[model samples]
Target: MATDQHLTEHTTAREELLKGHVLHVVRDTVRLPDGASATREYVLHPGAVAIVPLLDDGRIVLERQYRHPTRQVHVEIPAGKLDAGEGALACGQRELLEETGYVAREWAYAFTMYPTVAYSDEAIEIWFARGLEHRGARLDEGEFLDVIAATPEEFLGWVREGKVNDAKTLASALWIQNVLAGTWKLDWQAPPDQP
Candidate 1:
């Protein structure tokens, strides 16, 4: 394997082969450790964001939706694809409100991960939310889902029972549990905790 410094030193620039509405396929020029050079293609995406909005007592707000691509209904955290150049915090906040009709004052980043790094370059950032107030959903024209609130116990049961199926949301849920337990630090400063 090549080191970061070696890779950076030999790489000149990245160029694109395909630029679609959602992603750009690019070829990165790099030199190997053995003095060999090659170009590798990678899909570049704008990334996405999700939120695990929690009630003061630690109940998590989740949503159930039919994921046509998977041919199954997914119980997932409120999430959405990011708009071009949108901030992760903003996307998480908007997805929480738009999908679940809840607004939160306290927002803490929980985790950042790539959903699929192989064929796709999609990444997700999860946020933990508190101090929520009920609002109205502003869903997309084509969106459809049922909003539900679940405690970690209930949601984990769903996972164990094979109900919670979306990979990104499941990973977010597991990681958010640690955030609730005060284990990790998110980049964003959370608002004061409140019911």
Candidate 2:
């Protein structure tokens, strides 16, 4: 509501730490509001989108894949990073079709979340999709995962049992619960015409 200048930190200098194929790391010297200088190290991400694909039978589409960083198989929503110059909805559609093989007739924007606010500038745009038509999955090279469908109750149960622990997925669970209960409303729309 009010201005946040009191809590702002102005960057004094920046240094590139690492530039990888997927991750760009940087360090910045900042002048805090209290007149103190400090260094902040974080990853500059290309941003991403996660899709909560819903079925006519009230089930949700999900992926079971082994994440190398966590060294575990996680049950998560279909998601992928944005390509150069890609919009959030476009990324969501592409990822949903590419990862799960089902394209939706209706779509809605849920919300955006920063998975690791302290260390990564990675903002994930969450979307909702329904009226799905299955074509086939087009997995990227070296990418492997299993697509599964679950009822909301079953999925939430897995979450309660500590099975679905992905940050983005957890955030989507909150949205899904609220939306199902009619507490949160979504403005559903038709997919844009393809080129």
Could you say which candidate leads in lDDT?
2
Candidate 2, RMSD to the unseen true structure: 1.1
lDDT of each: 0.78, 0.95
- TM-score quality measure for candidate 2: 0.97
lDDT value, candidate 2, whole model: 0.95
Most TM-score-accurate candidate = 2
Residue 186 of model 1 has an lDDT of 59
- Over 78-99, each residue of candidate 1 has an lDDT whose tens digit, in order, gives 8878886877777877787788
Model 2, span 59-98: residue lDDT tens: 9999999999999999999999999999998998889989
Off by over 4 Å in 2: none
Residue pairs with backbone overlap in model 2: none
Q: Please provide TM-scores, in order, for all candidate models, with all chains considered together.
A: 0.79, 0.97
Off by over 4 Å in 1: 1-18, 27-30, 37-39, 182-195
Worst 10 residues of 2 by lDDT: 186-195
For candidate 2, give the lDDT of residue 184: 98
